[model samples]
Target: MPKKTEYVLRLYVTGASPNSIKAINNIKSICEIYLAGKYALEIVDIYQEAEVAKKEQIIALPLLIKKFPLPEKRLIGDMSETEKVLKGLGLQS
Candidate 1:
């Protein structure tokens, strides 16, 4: 049997901006529907924790990083594009 994959995701946002809020909500919804009990999500507010963003080399306001399961993936913007985000995370809609 194949080993189950556990997803480790990091979301970097700047304060409570609309794009940031949208990204957070979208990712949470996706995780609940797809990753459910097998995922760890860390939401980082760059405005409050600038060092984290700098250390992660975040260039965008709302960025999603899939840190686990090898070949880490990154998604930028508001994360409103569900299909694209899902594809980036190697998941089917």
Candidate 2:
């Protein structure tokens, strides 16, 4: 049988604003608790790398984009909605 692939998660944030901080922190906590050593995460600060944001077509701050494992997904805002994020990322039942 073929093997199942894991996820490559990338978070694009505008800056160190409160929303961005929350999103980063929440995602990191989730990844550590759930994803752990199986996933790779990159926090891209759009304020420092505006080109990255433009390339990703990010229209908002605190955007979390799941890049790998096929069928990419995006979550906006502070990532305060943990269950929703987990569900959308295929990390929850």
Candidate 3:
């Protein structure tokens, strides 16, 4: 049997803004439902980690980056749309 794919996700947010909170909730829900135990999620607050944000070249708030499993993908917004987020994460065709 093939090993399950492990996803590495990084979410860059700006403080505790509503959009950032929403994004965090949405992504956490998505990962729980979809990726489950096969994913690693890191939430980074740009306000607290300015250097990390600058190094990542983050120009938008509530950004989700899928850094593993190849062909890195980025999505920006509150991540309320499940289908869109799934597609961006390569979980859907």
Candidate 4:
């Protein structure tokens, strides 16, 4: 069988803020339900990794970057909207 396409996701957020926490939970839930074992998620706290944030050029507090599978995409928000998140991740039409 062919291997499933693996997704690489990087979530950048500030320290423990409400929006950051919400974005984490929301993205996790989405990944569990949709991406399942086919995704690698990396959460980066700008406070702890300022250099990473600088390198990534993150201007927003809560940002989700789909780094793998080509055509990299970015979404910025708390990620409360499931449909929007799904669409952003290329899981929905």
Candidate 5:
């Protein structure tokens, strides 16, 4: 079982593209609603910090990663699909 109200997330995005912006905003909104202050969000802009992205082995933009509470998970896209995003991070039933 996992501890309550603990989350560590990393979002990797490109420049200021629409999809990237949408991904950042959507993840922020979701995390605020669901994880709130218990969450630690790290936003990495690949265009500005490609080193970080390379270290993470990211090949694409707008990637959301849940990296705590045991096994990690990754989600790619603008994060418009709640179910997919939640399930990817083991947040849904």
Candidate 6:
């Protein structure tokens, strides 16, 4: 049997702005529905952790990074578009 893929996600945001909140909610919903207990999600507020942003080279306000399962992927936006976000995260075609 094939091993189930585990997801390691990192979300970079700018404080509690609406866009950031939306991104968080959207990703959380996606994780719960799709990843369901097989994922690790870390939220980094660039406003608080400037160093992390610099290290990650985050150029967008709301950024999502899939760090595990090989071939790292990144998506930028509020994450409100479920289809696009899923596609970006390789959850959908």
Q: Per-residue alpha-carbon lDDT of model 2 for 1-93, expressed as tens digits?
A: 543338788898867799989999999998888886778888988889878766889998788889987789988888888899898789886
lDDT of each: 0.89, 0.84, 0.92, 0.92, 0.85, 0.90
Question: Which 10-residue span in candidate 4 carries the lowest summed lDDT?
Answer: 1-10
Backbone clash total for model 4 is 0
List, residue by residue over 66-91, the lDDT tens digit for candidate 5.
88966888889999998888788777
Model 6: pairs clashing at backbone N, Cα or C within 3 Å = none
lDDT of 1: 0.89
Q: Mark the regions of model 2 whose C-alpha exceeds 4 Å error after superposition.
A: 1-5
Candidate 3 segments whose C-alpha is farther than 4 A from its true place: 1-5
- Estimate TM-scores for all models: 0.88, 0.87, 0.91, 0.91, 0.87, 0.90
Q: What TM-score, to 2 decimals, does candidate 5 have?
A: 0.87
Clashing pairs in 3: none
lDDT for residue 47 in candidate 4, whole number 0-100:
94
- Give the local distance difference test score of model 4: 0.92
lDDT, candidate 6, 43-76, per-residue tens: 9888888888778888987999999977999999
lDDT of 2 at 77: 80
Estimate the TM-score for candidate 4: 0.91
Q: Which of 2 and 6 is the better model by lDDT? A: 6
- Residue 55 of model 4: what lDDT? 86
**Model 5 ranges off by over 4 Å:** 1-5
